[model samples]
Target: MKKRLDLAAFRDGILSGSRVVLGQAITLVESALDSDQELAAELIQSLMSHTGRAIRIGITGVPGVGKSTFIEAFGKMLLEKEKKVAVLAIDPSSQLTKGSILGDKTRMESLASDKRAFIRPSASGGTLGGVSGKTSEAMLLCEAAGFDVILVETVGVGQSETAVKNMVDYFLLLMLAGAGDELQGIKKGIMEMADALVIHKADGENLPSAKKAKASYQNALHLFPSSPKDWSPKVSLASSLSGLGLEETWREVLRYEYQMKESGFWESNRARQRINWLDEQIHYLLGQAFLRDSKVKQTMDHEMENVRTGILNPGTLAKKLVSLFLSTERPQ
Candidate 1:
């Protein structure tokens, strides 16, 4: 089994145009079991030695913003331009039953049929830490699979999809028209992270509303300092169903890419992502290792009870757990 899951052979398969193997590797990486997770991280480390090729994009939206439909249309448009696109969608709702109402493949029908595009649903397995911490590795596998563009669609919780944004070259946030809570849904902090915001369903009777929404977003965006990218975040209108403004949206994405590259922010940002990925993985594995301790397990069960009983503060309790954990370290 170890030989079968060997990272070197898997690396070769990805480089040799075997997308199936690449997909399987991502599945392994996204697994929740400890053994599988360790093997996955090992494989990803081997593959990371050959990195920095694909353009990673993270797309996030509030619920009902038509993200899946927009991805379908946008993917079709990318394939038209002869670009290979890979989409990894993280839907938190898959936690309970491992079920998705409209899984990425089913929702993005056209892209699913397109040979140049690959769409995979999140095998989140109840871990919301960006698909059990496999998202970054899966992205690397997608890049090795020769997809020039990768879109990571994050959970629509509107909380801190910040993890996805930190991994990608450009981040796109989608919004709807006449939502009444659009402004409230998109706080200044979240909007500031966006490279571009697209008002979806901008066709037929909704055109005017989309325009209004776009103007409002644009005005709101101007109030914040410019994004890390040299170009200011742009707001556009697009009808994913009618395919209106789809081309312009892609063009603006490319424009943002080029502008960032010209300003040297592109390379710097990617390097920063690499460092962050390393730090995050280290943090995750250490936490996992700490949890393996029997004392840690007992402490966890005890800490929650203490919190519930108001006998201990969360921060101080957490520090005690960590202190005990460090002091009780065994074999490395």
Candidate 2:
């Protein structure tokens, strides 16, 4: 086993922006061990005052939407403006093997090597939202490390977009022009959640179509109900290769931040997100406890087989398991 750091060591290392310690601290939080979790919680509590300063932006879209490329360009741009950036890229894990490529660092070579930027790629671990379960914690750690911008790049499939939206101050959806029926290429719900729609790869011969797609998206956005914050989502074309619209995209983010802060929605939204996080944690803890119960573990396979064979109802088995779990003796 790797030697564990005391709470003070973890806390001080993270606050002092020690990259090695920061990585180890993130690993500690992501660990499944009970001792590590206890320490991780203490570290987070100690650093609470230092977090929530960075602008959290989640970028996601369909496969091949150039998410990594866009983030690299955007991160580099932020660095140019003398801003510190941290990227939390979530990679999908294979269901059969439970292994992940964790290739974001490889994909974003330049940005990963930069001193002003930090990139941490995590495996989704079959999480439904294209994000790892510990992503929010990692974001807080990054914020505490003095990153001005936190970019969360999701797997861009299924419910990943919605999952990311809840944790971020801004949601950026990247789309490819001429991929299919412009509006039909992605779900309406995902589009509605975006604070900005970026038509990526808008360079060379694709610029015109990207521009056309921009207009289409702009019109479509107008038809949706107005946002509660009274801020309209902006659609723009960007090319990661030629650096088109990168600055404009940052400007929109800043403008949205200003407008939302002015209207008091920024803090309110973050408050709501915290509550949601609490609820999710409750559910996760309950589930973990249920699975770890000795009695439940002893009967789970039998009950599952019975259910598979239609000998027991799933709901009945679930209730039975819960009862067994709750009835199990606990050490007070």
Clashing pairs in 1: none
The window of 10 residues in a row where model 1 has the poorest summed lDDT is 96-105
Q: In model 2, where do residues sit more than 4 Å from their true spots?
A: 91-105, 124-132, 179-184, 305-311
Single out the weakest 10-residue window by summed lDDT for candidate 2: 96-105
lDDT tens digits, residues 163-190, model 1? 7888899899888889675656666667
| Tens digit of per-residue lDDT, candidate 2, span 1-332 | 87888999888888888877888988888787889989888899899999999999999887778888899899999999999999885554434322222443377789878888888766446444323458888899988888899998876366666667888999998999995646566888988999999999999999999899889889999999998789899999999999999999999999999999999999999999988877777777787778778889889976788899999899998888988887888889
Top candidate by lDDT = 2
Error of 1 at 56 (Å): 1.0
For model 1, the stretches where C-alpha displacement exceeds 4 angstroms are 1-5, 33-35, 96-105, 130-132, 313-316, 329-332
Model 2 root mean square deviation, Cα atoms: 2.4
TM-score of each: 0.89, 0.92
lDDT of 1 at 119: 74
Q: Give the C-alpha miss distance for residue 237 in model 2, angstroms.
A: 0.6
